[model samples]
Target: MTVAIVGAGAAGAAIAYALRDADADVTVFEKSRGVCGRAATRRKEGCRYDYGANYVKDDDERVTRLLTEELDTNGLVEVEEPVWTFDSAGEISPGRDSDERKWTYEDGITQLAKRLFAATDATVQRETRVETVAREEGRWSLADAADTVLGSFDTVVLTPPAPQTAELLAAMAWDDDRRVAAHDAVAAVDYASVFTAVLHYPFTLDRSWYALIDTDGEHPVGWLAREELKPGHVPEGESLLVAQMGHDWSGDRIDDDRDQVLREAVGHVAELLDDDRFAAPDWTDRQGWRYALPDGGVTGDAHRSTEDAGLYFAGDWVAGEARVHAALRNGFAVGERIVEARNAKTY
Candidate 1:
């Protein structure tokens, strides 16, 4: 079986990793230059920051087991650090104030996908934007912007967020009630936009573990982190903060003036943290995530799933969505379903 996976993030990588040992031929296609999709990282000047998922968690049992096994072979460590949760009220919930949080990786979280992608013929196409996926003959057609053909494969496993997936599927004219339902699920997969400001500070923060604030504050940065603790991602002593701004605020602003967004973010964060002397760092960068998390997360109905079948889909939005662990489990389950379907077809 030759399988083509779209959107090479946690979902894509995990499926590839699970199927790499199989006899089937797998090709992982990524539109971006590097894998990691939302779990992405960026480097500028002399500072490094995690622009996407700042951390990989073992929140679920299966995810814990999978990561634990992978950690044995890969260079992942366990940090007992705690993470704080805050609200728009400017009130504070000091996380890991007494201890550290659980974390892994010697490099950035993207390393996990890189490791998975390295073993098989599943090459990731960076800087390659997928124009459309049209069914041609018995196989599938993947096209680029010029309407040129990229490749033909027996199956396609897509892992893009709901909205993007819907657009792609609609372009293919692959309209089934189920398919349309999958597209609708993306809209129902309620999420908010986020603006993350990554700055390198000379000193550490008030909390070693980032704080989640809530106190009638307009700025609700989901949570704050020291950045130093997120192994292999940031420097040893420098400070980095990613503020998950309110969706309404982030949506209206990020598309217009990014620098203005940054300045305003820094100023708002300073107020929430109760620090007047807080000044912007010499080096600063920003990132925006539109489909950050949903209100109810992924469930069987909320996320699309097909066992080892054609035209499958999975992401953080499936079965316990938004969490790193849930995403991993979705990948594992989808891969198994695919493998099973292939076996059945062979028999």
Candidate 2:
């Protein structure tokens, strides 16, 4: 069987890794140059920090095994500090979550996808944006922006966000009811906006916890994490902070001027941290995510619409959770389902 996967993010990469030993030809297409999507990292001035997802939690044993045993490339390390929470008033307190170990790579979180892809024989084509998918004679073919046919496959898995997937399916010329239903169901997936700012200082910052979260939902800043706490992320005598704006604030200023946003974000961070020096970082960077987190997962009725057609969907939202672990779980389940379907076709 030949398989083609769109979006080489966590879910897509995990699916490809699972099928590495299976007797199938797999090809992955990624629109961006990097992998792991929102679980992204940035490197600057000898500092490597995660600007998107801070770290991965070991909430699922399967994911834990994959990180520690299966995909272990000597870069997986545990975070020793606890995550603290605070309100808009800057009153810090202990977090309510379990004492599970937090995980990250010495290089970056994107290493997870890189390692997974490396373990597979799949051909990953970067910078390939699949515009539409058409089904013909029980096979699926992908087309790019210029209407060029990428490839035809026995199975196609989509791992992009729900809205993007809906757009792709809606563009198909086929008149199958399953396609229309999938488009409608996926189109309804809602997401939250997030604006992140990465700041670097030449001096050291002494903080007890690795990160702080605004639990009351009343602060302009939703989260603030010290990237230097992660080993090898920051050079000695230097500090890096990743500050994320709240949903309302992010949505309001997402399109604002970059300088204006950065100035306001630094001010907000300074006030939140009770340090005037935070207002003036040695270097700074920013990113705005329109679909940072999914509000809710698509209903199962919608998921069932494409199952019989050998069209599978996997992502953090597919499992009704906005965590890295959920995406891995969804990928594993979808890969297994696809393998089963392929075997049935051979018989």
lDDT of 1 by residue, 171-245 (tens): 774544655565566555566677887766677775644445343335545455566666655666667766666
Cα lDDT for residue 301, candidate 1: 58
- The C-alpha lDDT values of all candidates are 0.69, 0.87
lDDT of 2 by residue, 1-347 (tens): 89999988889988998898789899999999999999999898999999988888899999999998888659787778878999978888887446798888999898888998999999999999999898898889899999999998888899998888888888876778888887888888898889999999999998888788999887989999998888878999999999988888888888889778888989999998889998899999999988888887887577666767778888987887988888888898888888888777871
lDDT of 1: 0.69
- Cand. 2 Cα-lDDT: 0.87
Please give the distance, in angstroms, between residue 310's alpha carbon in candidate 2 and its true position after superposition: 1.6
Poorest 10 consecutive residues of model 1 by lDDT?
300-309
The estimated TM-scores of all candidates read: 0.87, 0.97
Q: Give the count of colliding residue pairs in each prediction.
A: 24, 0
RMSD of 1: 3.0
